[model samples]
Each structure stands twice: as structure tokens, then as C-alpha cells.
Target: MNTNDSKLREQIAYFGRSMFERGLTAGSSGNISVRLDDGWLMTPTNCCLGNLDPADISRLTRSGVLVSGKAPSKEFFLHEAFLDRRPTDRAVVHLHSTYATAVSCLPDVDPRNVLPPLTPYSIMRFGKVALTPYHRPGDKRLGDEISIVAAEHRAVLLANHGPIVAAKDLESAVYAAEELEETAKLFLLLQGQRPRLLTPEQVAELERVFGEKEDDRAKTCC
Candidate 1:
């Protein structure tokens, strides 16, 4: 194995543990993936994220065939949908995070854009968070729905499920997922009291400045 692949394995485990310990996800309820030159590295199925072993991370071929380690997560196709549609994206994070899943369960959110313009970072990281139609967990239909919106959105909330985020790298995908959950919490917190949002022009300016470079967004946004 190359040095980069080894590091990516450790990175996945590190973030998986962090997410699990912090309640971003629970049990074996979340998945993560990083695109490689030949294929991808993904968290194994039915494993607690908090207890991931770097060596046990699944390595799959470009065609999604398992090449090493354990079996990939059942939600493999969900990440596949984004990686297939967004050629430039190198990582994908899917989490059954509490607040985001709670928001997904809500009936009144906009189908086209589940998240309102509640925070500048949300608008900056996710231009518009699309809401995919509900499908049972690991259902290929869920991935299919994601494929339809992947062209226009880098992030999506699975109806009655949770959120999935894609980015140029694993760190960004993970951070975006965290940001999504925080934004969801803020959304729910302000449900009764109408909160003012960024104007269209302000959102446009953010899109123009921080949108073009996903990798540089964090460095430049501050």
C-alpha cells in the first residue's frame, strides 16, 4: 500500500471515532469514503465508527468491487451516487446525525431546499441542501434520488433519514457534515421564532467568493 492510502485509512478511522464519540452518529449508523486513484476507501459495514481499525477499512475498485479488507457499508451506493455524479469530489460523508435527521423527519421543509438560509457557512458550504424522497435504508432508490440532485447540490438530506455531504476531500466532507448538523440544530431552535436570513444579494456574494474553491473555503472564509 502506498503512504497516502495508509494515511487515508487512519484518517477515516480518526474521524469515524470522533464523530461517533461526539454523537454525530451512533452504533453502526454512519459511513465515510475517500476516492482514490484506482478506486475508494470506505468504512466497513456493521462496525461502530468509534471503534474503527485502520486496517479493516474496505478498499474497493473503480467498479465498486471489494479489493481488500472488510465489506463496505450497505449505504455504499449512496456515496457512489455522489462520486459518480461529481467527478471532482474526492470524499463523501453520510451521518444519521440527530438534529439533521430530526429536520429530515419534518414534513414542512422545502423539498427542493431543506435548509433555509440560516447561516452564512451553510450557504457557503452547501449552496442549497436538497431533500431526497424517502426510501428505506440502503435502498438503491435512495441513491438514485441522490443522483438526480447531485448535479446541482453537493449536499442532500434523506427524507426520514439524515444528511450526506460530498467534497473535494475527506476533511471538508466531514466538516460540512458537522456544519449541516449545527445548521439543522439552529433551524429547529428557531422554528417558532422566525429568524432573519441573509438576503439574496448577500448569499450571492458568498457564493461568488467562497463557492468556487471548496478546498480553500475554510482558509479564505475567515
Candidate 2:
């Protein structure tokens, strides 16, 4: 009911609508959450992103208690585990984007190189996307696996699932997730044909530039 909470509520609803409209998620499949000074603002469990009401969002305490009405998403562990791993994170977005999930199901896709350096924007946004193996939806083990690589990755592909990204704010988080899906699309488009990859020197340089800033940021996890 306060000013900041109201603002965040609107922001969540706005992004949730964008995700659905943009086809990043379908049905009731995706969940979103952003960190608040008090706790977090998460989409209500089973609520389709396209139809979410700002006031219907769930508010969870730092200790993972549900402080408001409506149950939290069943995959709450995915969000909470990232927060535990990285205190600097401000938001988390998980989407079952078409391209990203398709790439995930491919056995040839490499975890270390989940997304190629197809565009500088992708590189600048998400340095390297770690690919985590498949786990059933809402499985706590998914969070555990993500925690292991969260320290080094800004984005990750959930094998047979989709992609999850964490960032300093909701906008950036959503943007990164979008880029992940785009890169995956490009990867599949270029499959069966060798595509031009960024040279090691270029990748190294990007890492050097972005890596410094990322490294200084409280030793964050994904």
C-alpha cells in the first residue's frame, strides 16, 4: 500500500504483461520476482503472467515466509536460491521462451557456451550463460544446481525447461532474458552451418571490460 510497493506492483504487472504479449511465456507457465527492501514481490502461484493484477502479487519475507495472500509460485526455490547465493541481485525472471527452450533440449548445446557471441548486446548483457541439466518443474534440486553456477553466470538455461536470468533490476533482468532467447534463436538458425563466432581475443576483451565491473560487485552469484 506504500508508495514504493505500489510502484513495484505496477512494474511487475507491466513486465508480466509484456512477457505474455511477447510470447516469452504461455499459459500459466512463468514466474517473476523482484527484490524489495523488505522482501520480494513475486507473481501469485498459478497466475498467468498475461492476466496478473498488480495487487494480486505475492509478498514474501526474507526468511521465505509468505507475508501476503495467494501462495507463492511452486518454483519459488529458483528465485529464493539465487537471492541466497547473491545478495546483490535485485530481480529474477524465468521464462519458457520458445527458442531458448528448444536449444536447451539439444544434446549438442554446450553449457559453457550456451549462447554464441552473435551480437554485442548479448555479450554485454549476459557474459556466459551456464546450462543447467533438466529437473522437474518446482524441483528444489534445480535451485541447488543453479546455486553452484550462479556465482559465475548472469543467465542460465534450464535444460528441457527454459532460461532464467538475474540482474540488478527488473528491467535489466527482463532484457537479459529476452536476449538469451534471441541468442538461442540465432544459434538454432545457424545450426548445421558453421557460423562466425567471436574470436577468443574479442571474447577475452569483453570479459576484461565487463568482468572488472562484475567482479567488484559484492562477489555476486547468478
**Structural similarity to truth (TM-score) of each candidate:** 0.97, 0.92
Question: Candidate 2 local accuracy as lDDT?
Answer: 0.84
lDDT string, candidate 2, 20-135, tens digits: 99899999988899988888889988899998888889888876688885788888889888767778878999999999999889887678777778766677677788899888
* Candidate lDDT (C-alpha), each: 0.91, 0.84
| Tens-digit lDDT string for candidate 1 (1-222) | 789999999999999999999999998899999989899899999999999999999999988999999999988898988889999899999999999999999997787888889888998777799899898997899989999999889989999999999999998898899999999999999988979998999999888888776668878656
Q: Model 2, residue 157: what's the lDDT?
A: 86
| Residue pairs with backbone atoms closer than 3 Å in model 1 (clashes) | none
User: Once superposed on the true structure, which residue ranges of model 1 sit more than 4 Å away at CA?
Assistant: none
lDDT, model 1: 0.91
Q: For model 2, where is the 10-residue window of minimal lDDT?
A: 213-222
